[model samples]
Target: MPELPEVETTRRGIAPHVDAARVTELIVREHRLRWPIPPELAEHVTDQPLLALERRAKYLLFRFPAGTLIVHLGMSGTLRALTEAFPPEKHDHVDIVFDNGRRLRFRDPRRFGAVLWQNGNPLTHPLLAALGPEPLSDDFSADHLAAQLARRQSAVKQVIMDNHIVVGVGNIYASESLFRARVDPRRAAASLSRIEIENLTKSVKETLADAIAQGGSTLRDFVDSDGREGYFLLQCYAYGREGEPCRVCGTTIQQIRQGQRATYFCPSCQH
Candidate 1:
């Protein structure tokens, strides 16, 4: 699945071509996604100039006068800008064609992505209304994380990965952040001290900022809107480095399963 950094990367990569451009078309080759594509999405957005392009969590918000179009690049999904109308391939699902002959195409092999229309305040939409603060925002400070993690018996790794605690800290980022903070993934969330929380908060921000800067980790065919593969995985300290020497301490990086997702950490470096 595309994480926050990958989604943000897509938003930044495509905004230059689509922002303020009038929608000439909204083509949906397949309506069966994580949610059904609203049948009237084209009628609702056609002719409206996109006011802005923003990202909330992993969803891309296409702002327009009438409303907003919410797009989620699910597992194996990608949105790319095309200068011309390339013939749709097997997984090519939707297209947002612009008046300038440019096109924004969506392809999802797993059909778990979404394109939904929302009127009024898009933030109030069910899919978004309850989301936690962005990890990069000031609202997600150490105090905030400490309050949320208080008395929670779950592992610190799983707690940080919770969407309600802080948005967009997915599996890869959670592991990397914990590794950076030198916190053991299996440690109880409530066992963390203030200093540990401070370090963890900083690590989350730094890891995510670094991932966004590096274009995000390309796991299983992920690419930016411009079709560029992210190489952040190559720089990872723990994720997918199982049995490899730790970059920081030369101890073999270990991988364990948490909540059915892979968790990687350094035994000597992380307590």
Candidate 2:
């Protein structure tokens, strides 16, 4: 699935072509996604100018005068900007044709992505209403993380990955952040000290920022709106380097399964 950085990258890539452009047409080739695309989505958004484009967690918000169009790139979804003459491929499921002749196309091989209409404030939508603060925001500070973790008995990585604690700290980023902070993934969340929490918070922010700058980590089926794969995977420290020498201490990186997801860490480095 595309994480925060990937989604944000997509938002930035397509914003210039889509924002402020009038939607001349809304085409839904396949409405059977993770959630069925609203049959009336075209009726609601057609001819409306996209006021702005924003991202909340992994969802993309296309703002308009009447409401917002919320899209989630579930596991293998890719949104791209193409010309009106561009041919739709097998997986191309939807397109929003703009007055400028550019079309925003959504392709998902797995059909796990979602397209929904929000008639009111998008933040109040049930899917987004209870989401925690954005990980890259000022509101997600060390103190905030500490308070949330103190109430959870789950593993440190699991707690951090919880969307209710801090949005968009997915499995790969969680392992990378904990490794950077030198905190063991298996540690109980409530057992972290203040200093550890601070380090973890900083690591999370830095890791995410770096990934965004590199265009996000592309393990599989992720590409920006321009159809470019992310390069962040080349800079990973511990996420997938199992049995390899640690970059910092030359210790053999180890992998374990927590919450059914693989976690990588340096035994000699992370406590």
Per-residue lDDT tens digits for candidate 1, residues 1-271, read: 8999999999999999987899998899999999999999999999999999999999999999999999999999999999999899999999999998889999999999999999988999998999999999999999999999899999999999988889999999999999999999999999999999999999999999999999999899899999999878989999999999999999999999999999999999999
Runs of candidate 1 with Cα error greater than 4 angstroms are none
Model 1 scores a C-alpha lDDT of: 0.95
Residue-level lDDT tens digits of model 2 in 135-221:
999999998999998867889999988898899999989999999999999999999999999999999999999999999988787
Q: How many backbone clashes does candidate 1 have?
A: 0
Candidate 2 residue spans exceeding 4 A from truth: none
What TM-score would every model get versus the actual structure? 0.99, 0.99
Candidate 2 minimal-lDDT segment of 10 residues:
81-90
Error of 2 at 6 (Å): 0.6
Question: What's the residue-level lDDT of 191 in candidate 2?
Answer: 94
